[model samples]
Target: MAKNSALIEPRLPRGFVDSEPADLAAVEEMVAKIRHVYERYGFDPLQTPFLEYTETLGKFLPDTDRPNAGVFSMQDDDEQWLSLRYDLTAPLARYFAQNYQDLPKPFRSYRQGWVFRNEKPGPGRFRQFMQFDADTVGAAGPEADAEICMMMADTMDALGLAGKYVVRVNNRKVLDGVLQAIGVADEGQKLTVLRAIDKLDKFGPEGVRLLLGEGRKDESGDFTAGAGLDPAQIAAVIDYVGGKVPSGNEGIAELDAMAALFASAGYGEDRIRIDPSVVRGLEYYTGPVFEIELTFTVQNEKGQDVLFGSVGGGGRYDGLVSRFRNEETPATGFSIGVSRLASALKLTGNLSSRPATGPVVVTVMEKDRIADYQKMVAELRAAGIRAELFLGSSKNMGKQMKYADKRNAPAVIIQGSDEREAGIVQIKDLAEGAEAAASITDNAAWKAERPGQYSVPRGDMVDFVRQIPAVAAWMEVNARP
Candidate 1:
């Protein structure tokens, strides 16, 4: 007997997930909807490689303790560190810098790809996930940032989240003014303050106050060393976060400017709001910062009602490209966390619950007549109908129908020896058959209803199947005219 090899258990890395077929289909649908919105705004699609030179990506994240804290990086053969991009914007910055002379100024482009982050993931957070980003590079005005906010709102509405969400806008300069007012001048202390403030949603006002002053120790007894500001400074910071200070008025003014732009564009306060609380936790944003938050609440793992936070956000980074070129090249963009948004949509019942319809299965009645089954499948497919020939070992009619049902097939094509002799084919509407089977009881009633099964000429199989409402409706929308 051959020696048994050690059995290895199949497992995914922590904070990573495997997307099944249905999950992938849902994600694709969301991407298509978002892509349509981006393209409508005249933003071109762009594809960038997943790997970038570590230096090119840069260490912009607020965590400065470890230079490579948030990113996944490894040294290449040439001893140069290459990191999987943590976000799309950084890669876009690198791309723009590399092709600065050739590419169009104010390069408006959208990209959808997987980004990796080496963070301790928890509920709704993952190590690897999809992001759809739209950026307008080389545009310096607040209007460019305003346009991004508008586009973000439109994209959310496009994804069936019209009244269910809001785009909260704020300005880093406004926050900077607040920090200056409070006398938190040091960059490290300022970042710590920003980081603490960013947790306002998770840790409410009192919790944030604790962090702002001394520090916060969670339920797990983990002490997060805070900024250690004095009581007056903490009060100022809290007041700023609450939109109650002279320092935040600059940011408030910027938000008002953006609001005017939105109003002129017919996007009223209903869609977008000037919320000073939105201190986006990114060091790169030098101007306006916005976060898209779902207004609706859903039950968490503990069955507690919780708000879905920050589906997507972006802001003006005037210095990202300037990192490469000495001259200032202002840019602004927004990115939707594809997985988070999709999951939220699903939970809220806003997501399309349409079942994943499979190809119409052409069952093989006889092994010798496989060629005939293939021909039927070919005809259906040629007419732009999704179809497949059953290649299962079981030739049992019942088992074939079961397979079709398992596939969520709209219909099944049948051609037994008797049907073939008559030069015809039987098309059973699996969808309709299942529906009728759930309701109808008697054999006579089933035969009289013939619920979804229909017999048509061999040549007319495609046309006949197309007549089925479920099949035809999908074809009309998906197939070519």
Candidate 2:
């Protein structure tokens, strides 16, 4: 044997994580909540392969400032280039084009999955994350755009973020028309201007003024090159973003036309507003573009209100499928940054509910009682309760209970030869044990107050555990679709 041995790898790379029960439950809750809202909006769920041919998914996302890729890439078995999808929307475009004739016209679907980008990582930014996306295929017009906006609002509400979030809407057509009016005909230059305008909220009008004209120097002393627009062109872009949210009846006239359709479907004014600032970064949008902006503000590193930026955004891309199909079919959609939203919620204290680690812990009463402990967990499982036997070997019974406490087990069941002979099993409510642990310094007082912890008939084990659901569960069930 060598004098020294090296340790095996045991940690994950940056931007990757494993969620324990406390963290995972919060994510699942939000996912279910958003999916419920999507289904209510007539969007069905969809999933696709993680890998795609690089040729099939062309370069369209602008302003990410990475190589011929922010996407992770590799070679296929035949040496064909392939890449992981950077956005859920891009994969949908590929899916639609591949199965155009088989699927219904105006095919509507919602997809939630992980995406990858090889972009630089920063605070609150990650290379791998999950997105919840929904798209309406084969629909043009503002009605589809309005539907997406409404779904965005409702989805926020469902996720307990209605009061905390807002959906800002703008028509890419409107912005494009504005650009055309400004005398920008070069297709490449047109896109550069559009992307610069999208960041108006971040850079402000003056900052955007620099992004449009010459390059602008950020406060961090970094330089960003402009899209090269003249003063006249920059002003037009500025006016739209800074424009008012026209009020009263005439103010929201264009918006009302779309809202009325949702009204008929019973979704009302609590969601969506016809704001002008929602120009997104993508050049593919043919009509409206919208973003889910968190209305609640958190201080940035620079200690300023940034409106929580966009946790998710999507818009009408009528030309995406056109690249594949001979005919141009219009499609509109929205995507939620599951990772970003999860991060914000965790920061803001919404995802703070701590659930009991699991159901019962079958304490290892003695070395000989392993079989008995295993049988106790089996009974709990049969009764629809989560449970596990104490896998750790310990001689001290007190240490076993301490282990149960660390596991956050709601209850601990113990069996010894004496209890087995009497057909009774000892059950301690760890949920109650926690409350008992926090106070009552005297061990005698602790034991006395836990009057609920006592031996029960083997047949009554399920009943005893059922009584503790309210004590251990941190979430409620809502079945309404």
Candidate 3:
């Protein structure tokens, strides 16, 4: 006998999750809506591989405490290093540079796929997630960035999130200019200050002040080293983040142009607005940056009410593609965090929570009648109804019914020896039967009532099954264009 320890445990990695049918359906619905918005804005679909040469992704990895930094890296057969892409934008830059000659000057495209990160997962954070991104390469003007913001606003509206979300816009150059004005010249300290500003909403000004000077210890007593700055430098940084300081930086000019475009399009402050605290943590963002912050509040696992934070954000990376070519290739884009947005929608009751209706099950009544059962299934599918023929080991009627129920099947078709000889099939409407069974007191009365059972001619099985509410609803939803 094999030892129990020899068996491999069925489990998933900590930062990964399995998508059930309903989750897949919700994501599909969201993707379709987002695609519609992107297409309406004249963006075409593009796709890239999951892995790329690690160098091709550039050295800009997200800040993480893990040893691997942020990406999952591996050595290829030829000793070249390859990594699972940390974001869709880097792969896009590589693709555009390689195919620059044949492509149009201002390439407008959208990509949707899974991106991996080698970071610790907590609560809503995961190592692998989906990002739906739209980018406009070769466009340096702030208008390209403005259009992206408008499209993001439209996408939220299309997803029925109107008035519940706000697109906060900012400029990295504005923050950079602020750092220069304060005489903070060290690159490491500059990055630390930018990240501290990004955490204004989470930690408030006092917590950020500590991050700017020395460091702040969390409730868990883990001390994080901060940018060592004098009181003057810390106060300067705090004043800027509090919107107490204004600048005449070029980034400010670009933000002004974007703001004008937003007004011209009638996208009021409620939909999109300029704010200083939106310094996206990515190092590649050179100019305008923006983020979608959900304004709604949800109860956390600790039962405390907290505002749902950013679901997606991105900015211009004029320097990203320049690494591949001598001349600069200005690119601006944003990504929608599909999984995070889906989770928020699920919590707010905007996403459908009902389990997806399964196929119409054709139960095998006789071992010899398997062929007949398959024929019925084929006919139902031909009529655009989802269905399947039971291929289980048991031939018992009770066992077959139990199997269908487990499958969430709408109805089950039964043609026992007597019904087969009579040229008729019995259809048991599981959905209606369950509803009626809840009201009936006695099991005998429930069986006698046979609430949703129907008998029809063998040739009429498909048509009768299609009339069942659950099956008809499924067919209507899944109809081909």
Candidate 4:
């Protein structure tokens, strides 16, 4: 056996991640746009500390059962066990109840923050991720749910997911009625049954049928024990799911009511949908549960074409505040999974990937002229151009150009011996020049390429640097999304 050591392996435990800058940038854009839409709808931005008392957040969260049960947990100075929030909705509930007297009757607010869950991370699941949510408290009708659905529709349109996305809305109570009709007495079991039903797309009708009755043998050769119900009971669950669709009788009633609300408010079914598979996982949801599903397909982890599925979801938690205030306070909210949304947008070719800055590297030709190089950099900076000086000790001109290539520099300003003698500054259109060089052609032929490299006087650096906006515009026009 190998020698034992106290040090653990250098790796992340299954569900955690370190997001890349590209990923964060796309998400940031989406979050900013969504925030603007929320603010337009009159929701104030509110923030609360990530750490809160265990009693503060309450215990109805689907995964909150015991210590370190669902969320990351730690003990406080006063010996109170605190867990990271599982969702923004719970914390908003806590915020409303604590400041009940101070806040307006219908406290409207939105928050963007990181939420944690200590659950198994699969294809699109992670231990920690960011959520953007908007909520309205003190509202007690389907109108509240209706507003959330409207916001959901607007959010998709604002994010450019308009034609490609749809919102599936349903009431948790409607599901409860289905469960009651199916004879699932316990709420927990009903939720489990709903979760299984939600996976109908993944498992298909046969798989769901097995899950409703005895159990299922999945593609991975794993057996998921079913609710263990009789044939008649299982049939009811199957029938309920089958009955849900955009243009159906029961679904049409709910959709018609919501459509009338949005239609009066200027949104319509051209973007919204009513699908029964939207059984959201949060235990706090007491009313309508809405999910934004991507109709497009993206490559899965296995490089297979799988419908990317729902990218965001939320529902009404009418009883969340009751956990603390001991009185009913109805609240409805929507959350956008920014990271997943960004990923889907990226795969669908909807997100722009332009690296914002194109550096202008001033190549140093003379070691003694370091001061002149510094002056050139200063001039570029003064003109509001992204500029830097080549710090490499290499004297070879070819190697200096290579450095600019690595930096993705769009222009390389060269005041070489020849140019210095001519009283002109040799400027290379590094972006185009580099691209030209990368093509399969002779290096000398590429180097002597006349259309790219230009010469200007030393005093004209700013004017020359100003050409980038046009270059960027031209590139944008020529490129395909």
Comparing 1 with 3 on TM-score, the higher-scoring candidate is 3
lDDT winner between candidates 1 and 2: 1
TM-score computed on alpha carbons, candidate 4:
0.84
Order the numbered candidates by lDDT, best leading: 3, 1, 4, 2
lDDT of 1 at 53: 89
Query: Model 4, residue 82: displacement in angstroms?
Result: 3.3
Superposed by TM-score, candidate 3 places the C-alpha of residue 452 at a distance from the truth, in angstroms, of 1.3
Alpha carbon RMSD to native, model 4: 5.1
Per-residue alpha-carbon lDDT of candidate 3 for residues 90-138, written as tens digits (9 for 90 to 100): 9999999999999998999999999999887988889999999999999
Q: Model 1, 50-144: lDDT tens per residue?
A: 99988887878658767667999999888999999988998899899999999998899999999999999987789999999999998888888
lDDT per residue for candidate 4 within 202-289, as digits (tens), equals 8788888887777888778988777777888777777768874323345346556776787788766667766666788767787778
TM-score of each: 0.95, 0.89, 0.96, 0.84
Please state every model's RMSD to the true fold in angstroms.
2.0, 3.7, 1.8, 5.1
Q: For candidate 2, write residues 209-272 as lDDT tens digits.
A: 8888987898789987888888877777787677733244332454567667767766654556
Worst 10 residues of 1 by lDDT: 245-254
Q: Cα lDDT for residue 33, model 2? A: 82
Cα deviation of 318, candidate 4, in Å: 1.2
- Which 10-residue span in candidate 4 carries the lowest summed lDDT? 244-253
